[model samples]
Target: MDANREIQAPNSGCKHGGWVTLPFITGAVVGLTLAGVGWTANLIVYLIGEFNLNSIDAAQVFNVVNGGSFVFPIVGAIIADSFLGCFSVISIFSCISLLGTVCVALTATLSSLRPTACNGGSGSSCNHDHPSSVQFLVLYGGITLASLGQGGTRFTLATMGANQFEKPQQQGVFFNWYFITQYAAYVVGATALVYIQDNLSWGLGFGICVAANFLGLVSFLSGNRFYLHDKPRGSPFMDIGRVIVAAFRKRNFPLSSMPDDYYNPITQAAPPKKAFRFLNRAALKVEGDIRSDGSIAKPWRLCTLQQVEDLKTLFRIFPLWSSSIFLGTTIAMQASLTVLQALNMDRRLGRHFKIPAGSILVIQILTSAIFLTLVDRFFSPAWQKVTKKSPSPLQRIGIGHGLNLLGMAVSALVESERLKTVHDQPEPTPIAPMSALWLVPQLSLVGIGESFHYPGQVALYYEEFPASLRSTSTATISLIIGIAFYLSTAIIDLLRRVTRWLPDSINNGRLDNVYWVLTVVAVLNFGYYLACAKHYKYQNVEKEAAYDTCD
Candidate 1:
């Protein structure tokens, strides 16, 4: 038997789900990511250029928007797994995204919706047209709705794609492919769409985003007849609550040694493992715990062995998940800082071409996209050949941690160089003479690190999670990113209030110190992750050796 065939494929006799579903899934992911990233990629630029916000203010708004986009997925995932299912959730949100992009486009087209354009210069001399409170409300409304749409579809789409495969190895490979498509879309959006928004018209660029969103929805809906719709098993959160309540109620019941003392499935009647023995009380089969028909009689007094085990699994995984939050926080901070760095640095490629400040992040996106294929194709196979076993998810995450630390160090060195050049000047210059290409090395390393850890975390969560909570499993990543981004905002705000590291004018601020701080944070977080990975145990017994995986 194939070891990686972990889950029994549901409703196998039905004709849906297989390689045939790949094209539609791929199309949906590509179109949605393309449109979603188009606007998102140039957001700081838009808020600064179109909305007349200063650099620090724009970064703050960007973090909040980014955080919300990621945070909403948990709710969307719960609703899907509980009632609507992935198809419905994706469909509804795609339209919402389309509506949002259209509204944002309106802000670009209708001059009345925006503040009057500022004369191009700094300070009171430029006489900037500050957005009225009413104008800010209209603009924020569009961005908020778009973020909600983004939050709804992003991780849920990954869950839906993974569901199309039967083997655990295949599911792992699908996640890799999905991210490649996603990053490719990001590259295009950052480069081409940003060029349009910066060079041509914001309205036209946003119009293109709306069109792409619509097309993505169309492709996703076109595949409905071919999809294997997984029915919801009700809210898993309610079951989680039940487990806690039942265990507390039976806190005083003395544990029994007999095989029949606990609830078990008919064929799988083996006794529960001894880990977290306190939770085992929930599954204890007391005299009145079961009804005459064998159903659970007291909802809050008794739970199945599986429910107890599921809660225990979460308890074990939470520490590792918590470690990842700071990792994300550092990365989010870097993303914002990189844009600010590029804005101040020399962005020229040659005599004829100049790089867009916002589009510079595409280097990071492209590196991730290119290396995903390489890591999936060559790296894992080589590791398996040398070690006589495939690399596990924790091992991959450890490598990512090391690379992230190195990237932060490089970023600090680069910023120190850029600042030295600025200080050498007798007076403050609008832009540094140092080429923006200096930023690429750090971005690429961070990108490579993402190629390793992001997919590893996804596969690890999905493989280790209880079957009843699969959709929510992937959504957990969104939750981490969401919290990290919001925390980053708070950190930045605090820095501004107390220190001079992130001044409104980044050129005057100690940008290098910020990178140094993130490096220290990454170092401490990496140590924490190593401790967690060292003690953690793998839950999934399924291990298919046939396919090459990102791990």
Candidate 2:
């Protein structure tokens, strides 16, 4: 809490926004992140341990669930932007998440939902018991509902929280805290909750998640009076589609330089930019374009100048957006493979204290949470003080690109060391003697990188995108992540088929080569990002130094 912050009244008015709403919004963020990561962090373990799934089947199910969770945010965002406002959408989805968690908890509690437990002795594989159709239904149905709930609320809350502040700088500051809070909650979920789920009881673990989800819903609604809501102005996607159709229909029309030659809602409205000049024709007014009331006679053939420019903005951003795909893919792959690495190494902390393979990833989340605070408190100020300006969003993203690529390089080196240790070990020694803590540096580097790029990407997309797509803008990251999940699977499969880099026994395979390959790809992607960013122009005054102003 800021010392001088004023408490706003409970009246829901247009002036109700700014720091007054921070508590409620942040509370909701904590709840959602905690709840979402709880089940997700240990999903594969739950499937294999309880449902008697094979490693391959469990991994496949995890991918589907994870991918759905990331991809469904677009659906939530579209509904929020087009019909229900962010508040309604988030509230609705949070309940859906709670419901999903409840269903999962039921599965954990009820005996009928699970298959027979494995009874195989040491050094022998148990014949996996196949679950019945009804069991599968309950499990998958709950997963679907939960994914929908978590996905819809995740980034939509981000957009809503940012909307509380009018200043672009304040929004950026909110984003920083938003991610910090999220990463912190991720640590709790991945470590504490996962331990509870694995050691204590799955029912209790999921029940706690359900409670968290419900708490998030209540916390969000607590600020309803303080929220400055964006009224749904109909489907933004339709507007985007209309712009494309209109532009193509008028593609052959010559763009007129005169301002009056276009259709602007305001009488003296400025003309759209000439960047995508061909798109400007969508706003060009022909004799039959506008009716007596100034509405378009042909909805598909005519669009607002704003709509035309909005489409152009997406077109301009596409290249920079594409560069992030590989980054996301690398992140997904590393997250999955690191757990495997941990499983193969000495994960003991002290006598009788073995680290869970699933929880090893929390190191990354913990590092990100810690450094995000540093970036917010010390680093940004120091940078501003030394350079006479704060780092821009693009500068932050570029730094992240380098740091993340370096992390990949480090992963390769560490894997090489681990492989050498594997070779040095006496015959039949399964687990490598190398401490799993060696994996921490690579993960931490990526975590630190995320502290820069993740928030930077959020702020960049939110500020640069048109007002109509604010919610969708945040979800674009989700969409990118969704795509990357599939790409990661595809890449790993390709490696398995064509090369020995990712054989069944990673200790026998050239695992370091996989990291090196990712590193090379990331470096090339970084170069592409640089090229795009070098030529990219910030859309307006707000986009110019918005991130720096956050400091």
Candidate 3:
């Protein structure tokens, strides 16, 4: 057999043959679309200045527009797991995202047409700002629609992509390539977006996004035939109930350990119910279960409360995971606020060169790729040989967070240097813009931390949950992340309020203080995560052969 055919044989449940090309194509297209969205969003801030808006108003507008993405993933996950299957969910959402892209482009076009449509009056309070309430009503509607699609796209596509490769050994390589490609998109998208926003109009920037999203949609739709469609199991509510009922019966049923009638359906005659007295045992409390005599029968005996509590043990570990939201938010800043920070940096690469700040994102992307490749190819195997035990994903999380904390510390040092440079150098041309090179160490550290943390965290959440609650579990992780964003903002706000005594030179528009705050937060988060890691007892799902996975 050829390599492709060999890989497909083991994954009997997944349809891998004719559909292999579909996933790779879709992944690339999706990458382009996401890059496009990011580029357009960043361009809006620059475009807003053309409307005569002041710094604060412009910042608020940008925050509101970007922050709109926070809660939309929940909606996407709900629809995907419940009503629409993953494929349909992706299609519908991708299409809606394209609509949002169009709206963004139109908003820029319309602002040029009638700035009055933003605000009612003048002096930066114009009625026709980028998508006013009427426009916002339209814009937000599109955003909401697109968010639903985009949020679930990663979760579903990654899973579907993995499904395309079936061989046990190939699965590892498949996921490795999958993550590598996704991050590759992040790098390409970030780089391309930086270039586009610097050179193009906001309308063109967003118009490009629209095209990219449409391409993603096309790639997904075309591969519909090759995907293995696993119908989602029924609602957890019913399944949970069934499990409880069965557990209770197993405990309380008077059937005892007596050999239950064993029939070989292929060879034996059907045994009469009367053959086994245990069938009438009173302990079997299965509701509505009936006997052949039209009499009330039960499923089995009742389970002890202690038995139920045994299953409930997983709930205890949740608080530890949930509390990490604070950490998630701080880490997320690498994507959100870090971009803003880069934008504010002295972008002049040297005396004669001016590079876009967003280009710094490439540093992050490349670092992640290099580290991930190293871990899979070198580090993981080396560790396995030395310890005679593979590193658990949870173990990796603790280590990842430590690196993340160190990365934050490096960022603080970089910021301090920048602050020192601005204070000491009075000249307009201060010796090659204070060496923008300092940011490399910090950005590279963050990239390494990302490689350690993100993929492992994703796998951790899914693997830790009972199969029935995978969606709910993953959603919980997302919720923590969303909550973290709010918490990070709150912490920064609180710190700003407390530091109000500082002079503008040290405080205003300078993120040096913010770096310190993040540094402190990361240290505390890392410590907390380590403590949780020590106590966490990973579930051994492989050992539980007969247990119902229905929540």
Candidate 4:
């Protein structure tokens, strides 16, 4: 077998020096995340403060930008799987990201690129001056390029790092550290970078991001010789397409009950299992399907039983995947709105240090990082000891769904209280009398839910997806997040048109009603998730067993 084929094999040996590339890869992850989140964390504030956009418009822009960031990872994953491999793609996009960050920094430094300040005002009283077309295009161009670069690098980097390890144990360790680095970066970006932007200067803050991007690119390139480069085989998506086409073409053919009748690449194994049996016809032998050399002559007309089975596995998991979309949508909407809420509430901590509105998100990232460690270190093992089996991915995801619903409920209650405080104030102040810390409970609950579901989703996809699509499997989370953000934007826009729930000044609008709607949607989504989870079956039972053992 060729190198690419060997790499794709389940039992492939590690050719490169194991763990040598870990530090470089982890360093790059931290740097890239720092750069990416530095801008993204404070994006809404930047749009409102620098671009002079209204609160609602800024939130919408933030969602769209975040959605794009998530969407581009699928493109990156496809490119990594089909054309340029992960290392090459990461290298190319890293450079692109650095350039984009530089452009963003320039916009902050050069006053001409951004709109004038909103009459030097602090909050709702600020004048809402729209950016000129030229200014808007430049700003958006920078944001777009930066977002694309971030999308291409984030999950693809994880897959590339994981590829260096042959053992499942070591791979698990790498993933733990991978997420740790990512969340740590988010905490720093949300708190430190945001503080700098709010206190010092946007130019200085964005300049730091530019520096981090450059450093990350350099760090990634430095580990070039140590990395095990997985070369691009054809796109896995193409194989999925081929399976569907072949299955449909053979719809009239009858499936055989005997193992010998169906096409199995491995001579020793039994025929594909009974589920989705209609698809089994694609693997049924027909005259002229095979060449004299035993190769597939008409690839589109005939597929291996494994291909057919893999397609079925994807189909089985899709409803589960679809159900997670609304979960993410709720989180996305809550995150954007929480920042706005923080901006309106009293954000003081001590005598001198007042939290930045953008920095309030750091609470969630910090909670997730802490809880993730606790779960990995203590909770999983403890659960296994009590139950005699580690918790399944579906169970963990279900727990996440429940916690998410609770978080939405808490958010609705908090918003209601904040609105009451807003109404009770004798005079209209820029800030509400309520403390920003009230948002922490909902944010922390969301974080804890993430600690369960994010890893569960990644593990489920990685375990269930075919080896050929391993990289793409990891990127699937990004795809869902992207879609959810877009959906959230649409939902927000729809609400604005139809209801009084989300307006420019949330204090003047029924913001709590929006959270209540989300809570209801989340409850329905959880029901859908339960149904999907109960019916779904694992394709690789042995792999899941091994994963459980490793945990």
Best by lDDT: 4
* TM-score for each model: 0.90, 0.87, 0.73, 0.92
Distance from true position, residue 443, model 3, in Å? 1.9
On TM-score, who's better, 3 or 4? 4
Error of 2 at 455 (Å): 2.5
Candidate 2: residue 27 lDDT (0-100)? 92
TM-score, predicted candidate 3 vs. hidden true structure: 0.73
What C-alpha lDDT values do all the predictions have?
A: 0.83, 0.82, 0.55, 0.85
Scored by lDDT, model 3 comes in at 0.55
Regions more than 4 Å wrong, model 3: 1-37, 40-71, 113-142, 165-171, 235-313, 350-353, 425-432, 470-479, 496-498, 501-510, 541-551
Tens-digit per-residue lDDT, 1-551, candidate 2: 11112233346444488898889999998888888889888886787677876543455566677778899889988887678878889999999998998888889889888777544311113344678899999999999999999999888888788777767789779977887788788889999998898778988998899888888888989888888776666667898889888889999898888888888885677767878788898898987888998788999899888888889999998888888889888888888778767767998889967787778889888888788779989988998898777788888888889999999999999999999999997784558899999999999999999999887898788778887776577789999888887788788878878997765446778889999999999999999999988888888866565444322
User: What is candidate 1's lDDT per residue for 314-352, written digit by digit as tens?
Assistant: 999998899889989988988988998898888887797
By TM-score, the best candidate is 4
Q: List the residue pairs that clash in candidate 4.
A: none
Candidate 3: C-alpha RMSD after superposition: 8.7
Each candidate: RMSD: 4.1, 4.7, 8.7, 3.7
Error of 1 at 192 (Å): 0.5
